[model samples]
Target chain A: MLIDVTDAGDPRLVDYVGLRDAQLRRPEVSRFIAEGVKIIERAFAAGCTPRSLLLQPRWLPGLRELIDAWPDVPVYLASEALIEHVSGFHVHRGALGSFDRPQETGWDELLGGRRLIVCEDTVDHANLGAIIRVAAGLGWDGVLVSPGSADPLYRRAVKASMGSSLALPWRRMASDSDLQRLRDAGFTLVASTLAPGAVDLAGLEPPAKAALLLGTEGQGLSDAWSAAADRHVTIPMAAGVDSLNVATAAAILAYALRP
Target chain B: MLIDVTDAGDPRLVDYVGLRDAQLRRPEVSRFIAEGVKIIERAFAAGCTPRSLLLQPRWLPGLRELIDAWPDVPVYLASEALIEHVSGFHVHRGALGSFDRPQETGWDELLGGRRLIVCEDTVDHANLGAIIRVAAGLGWDGVLVSPGSADPLYRRAVKASMGSSLALPWRRMASDSDLQRLRDAGFTLVASTLAPGAVDLAGLEPPAKAALLLGTEGQGLSDAWSAAADRHVTIPMAAGVDSLNVATAAAILAYALRP
Candidate 1:
């Protein structure tokens, strides 16, 4: 059944308005509204099930089968004007889909026989998304998002990740105890930092299990976190340049430690 | 000498007009216009002498000494209205500077006994700028802008690079001869590609004299360039994820090859 929404205030479209904040609330109820067909299709292909799909009447004929593929999923068909109103912005390409928010992956499940990528205080949505995209590209096993990190499921992050957030396993951890749990699970926590005694990234031998930890772009990892790391490594940079963007740095670090 | 012309089309401000087209025609002219005090300072520190420092009347008192610090450099004062007109956009921060264009560095001189990062066809200004930022941070020797590559000096690219392009040595090459010369000089040409026999990035050895080659965002690399690489290496991404952004890939490669 294709429902139609005519107003921006439509109750059914509430989830899609001013979506930036909703994603940060709780991953379970925080739905990721993928607006374009490509992103939605990619997310779906990566095994994400859609909650409901909204399409411009013009696109319904071509997207009908994909919507039917999720037989129980509600499909909403609306006019272009209605979509623009409901979205609070022009619905440029004329389609949208809301996916049931997947629960955050378990730390144990994520650490199970895999290389881990940990982000601490990386709050920028685009950077977080880029990190996820690279994580998926470089074959890292999972991403562990610290409490201070942005939600990987944010619309911008999802789009920036090219929908790889759907494919990459991600979990959120709130404190030292959360990080310690991974350490207890036998994963070597390698902190990417510029501290004294840090080894050149290439010099370190690939560990059987390792979690590449990165910090905020402005202020790197907290002193406590760096002190807790099993190893600290730095990418040798030119004298005058500050540092790579957080996401770029994470990708490089992840690629270097891939088992 | 502060020249204040409030109108958008003031004659003295002609050089700074139509930045977008100027960028397309000759993006390397970036030494002429850069945003923010820090970037302007970096460019000056890197030996890019200013022709004239343009400023809104309000920021004049604070910037006078810095302008005076460059004794020979002219400090051009203008009204906020004039600055907006000349810049082709509102002077969001209320100041901008026009500096004398720096001489293009010789490729050999730029690469003299140091690591070189190469891009074949990376077209995104942000990605190119981010790569330059990474290059600066990672202690790479220089960057080689091959045919079809984005202009490093484009406004967005420069900003994204965080002005590292000023300190980093770069040169644009219009002919295949430049690449051939690099090859003959024993620079190991490593192309980031998905070609068969492309070693996993982690498995590769850091070369003494190497060029980390990259392609555009959507398309990976051209056959003509890919075949020229001494070796092809891949980041070994997870299944179903697209390629990493070029700048991110460059950072990873540069970090992997850090000396």
Candidate 2:
């Protein structure tokens, strides 16, 4: 169904209203907004059901084939100015898709993976997304984010992940004690920490199954989480410098420890 | 010189005028703004000459001792609203400093280092800054960005670097032929490319002196730069995924190839 929407207040455009607001970031939100052409394509490729699409006419010709595949999906055509007005930001890449949230990966499926990234309160959307991207790109089987972490399917995260958050099997942990379950599953819990006596990452021989636990931005892995790890590893950094950003650190660790 | 500045148009704040403008991003710009208290402290630590400071009243006490040490440098106290008005953006970090651009690292000093990051048109400020941060944190000696790359001293880059840019020795290339100079210095030119048959980063033995080449966001390395490299290296990513972000790639390479 192709609908031309002239009014920014159109009730049908509800999915895209106030995109910059906090509502869309909530984990309970039923739909995720896929921004730009590439992410929208990835959303479809990941088998997400498209609820609707809001885009300018110039974006139509390129995306025509993709949208035509879903004939029942409403394609709301609007002007570039109206889109900027409706979304409360410039739709610079010039397309947006609202899709039903994909089902979360199950614990059994997640535990079967050889390698995983387990994030603790890694709440920054872009950083979390980058972690997911690197994890998937390097052939890591899945991601397990803490309860307080940002939603992987959120627009900013999806954009940042280049939609790898959709491609990878990620599940939000119910509680911190999930670490116990991982340990019981025959996986080595390696915590990235600054604690003295931590082994250098280069020297460590990675085990058959390992979960790399990353922490939030300011405070590193919480003391309890740090204590629970089977081993502690540190990237030996130069003197007088602060630690690398969490996402960058994840990339280095993921590359070095890839199964 | 403790001066309370009320008017946003005060002549003392000239270095901060229209901060969002392209002028501040230009390599020719004489001064750079250091946002937040930590980076300001880093600016002083890096021996950058403080031209002046624009900050809120609440922040004065904590920074008093540091500012008092440089009595000749004028401290412009203003309301957060006033600072935000002048800077054309909210100074949520609550402080700012205008510092005379530090002297660029010379070729002789840079070439003497065993590990270096050479960026080719890595123009995004935040990405370039992250590269510098990772390079420094991983103990890479210096950074050499191509002529077209963003200035390492640009405000956004400096902030993203978490003040590592202040501590690291980074210089911009005079021309494309600077790669030749690096090769002449006996530094192995390792190009991070996606090309087939590129040596997997896991297997390659990094030479003593190596300069890793990184490119821009949308495009990978330019053909000429890739061809000029002494060896091509790649992170073996999983099938069906786009490549890693430039900054993330830099982090992995800097760590793996660290001296």
Candidate 3:
């Protein structure tokens, strides 16, 4: 059902209000907002149930099939100007869909995979999203994030991943002890660091099942996580440069250690 | 010279005004602004002459030696709030330096080395910066960009490269004939693309002197460039995923084709 919304403050459009405000975007609300027609399509293709959708009529034709399939979902049509006023920013792509956030994949299923990306405290949504996109693009099995990491389902993360975050398998660890669980399942834990004594990445012989541990942008793999890994690998960099961006580093490691 | 300026509109601080506004930042003026202490230090370390400096009083102690060395260069001190007001954004690291932009390296000097990254119309400063950082960290010799590419000296690009854009040897091509120059220099032109029939990146052997061509974010390598390349290499991606981010792709290619 298409509901035409003329008022920007309509209660039904609450999910999208002030979306640019970081404080107002709560991932715990059990719903994730996918922006643009492509990402919304990916969310639907991934079998996510739409809670509702808010978009200009111009986008309705493009998403008609997806909307038609979910007859019970409310599709709110609004003017582009109203969307900008409500979201506090221009909705350049002209569409947004609120979908039920997918549940975290079970650890047992995640650990059973051959290749994985384990991010520790990667708080930047763009970096986290790019990591997911890289992992999925390179055919990696899944992603595991520490509790402190950014929500992969956050609007910015989902958009940065070009919707790959919707299609990729990802989960947050209940606790750091999850590292031990990965090891217990016979997965090799490889820590990516710039510290000395780390084996050159070019020389690494990745095992059948490997978990690459990447850390934050500022403070790389924490001392505890670096010390606990089965191996430490460093991409040999030139003199005077400190390190690569966390996401770029992840991409290199993902491709090099691909199964 | 330490000059205390309480006014945000002081003409001496013109270089630091409206930094958040792209139209006001003119690289044609032969001056580029470096934000933060670390980047400013990189600019000095790279032997870039200081036109002037602006920062809060708290950061003075750290940069005392550098300031002392450049006795004639004026250092404008201001409160953090005034600095933010003038820059039109928070000077998060509390310092900004206006430095003389260095001249582009000659093609012969850049191509004398074995490896290079060639970017075409990469308008995004962050992507260009990341590519530079990846090139430097991976020990690539230099970078070449089409005339249409973003200025590597742009504040945002310099910061994104972790200041590597300042350290790396990069030059803009005068025209498409630069490709012919690389070819004449015995540099193998390898175009990175997602097009079918491109050789699998893993199986290809990089030439002794190779130049990897990267294109804009939305479009892959242009038809002319792709056709002119000596070889086309692609990172095999999983189905359903369109492509990796340009910077992420650059990192992977740089690592894989490392000399």
Best by DockQ: 2
lDDT of 1 by residue, B172-253 (tens): 8876568787777778888898767899877899888888888877788888888888989987767676578777888888
Relative to the unseen true structure, what is the C-alpha lDDT of residue B214 in candidate 3, on a scale of 0 to 100? 98
Q: Highest TM-score: which candidate?
A: 2
Mind giving the per-residue lDDT tens digits that candidate 2 earns over B95-117? Answer: 99999988889999999999999
| Model 1 per-residue lDDT at B161 | 90
Superposed Cα deviation of residue A234, candidate 1 (Å): 1.2
Q: What is the C-alpha lDDT of each candidate?
A: 0.77, 0.91, 0.91
CAPRI level of candidate 2: high
- CA lDDT, candidate 2, residue A2: 84
Give the range where candidate 1 chain A is weakest over 10 consecutive residues by summed lDDT.
Answer: A19-28
| Candidate 1 ranges with C-alpha deviation above 4 Å | A1-15, A18-29, A54-65, A71-95, A111-114, B1-32, B51-65, B71-95, B110-114, B205-208
Q: Score the docking of each candidate (DockQ).
A: 0.70, 0.90, 0.89
A70-184 per-residue lDDT for model 3 (tens digits): 9999999999999889888888777999988888788778877999999999999899999999999999999999988888999999988888888888898888888998899
Q: Compared with the true structure, what per-residue lDDT tens digits does model 1 show for residues A25-82?
A: 4555657778688888887887777888778878777776787787878787788777
The clash tally of candidate 1 reads 4
TM-scores for all predictions? 0.84, 0.98, 0.96
lDDT minimum window of 10 residues, candidate 1 chain B: B22-31
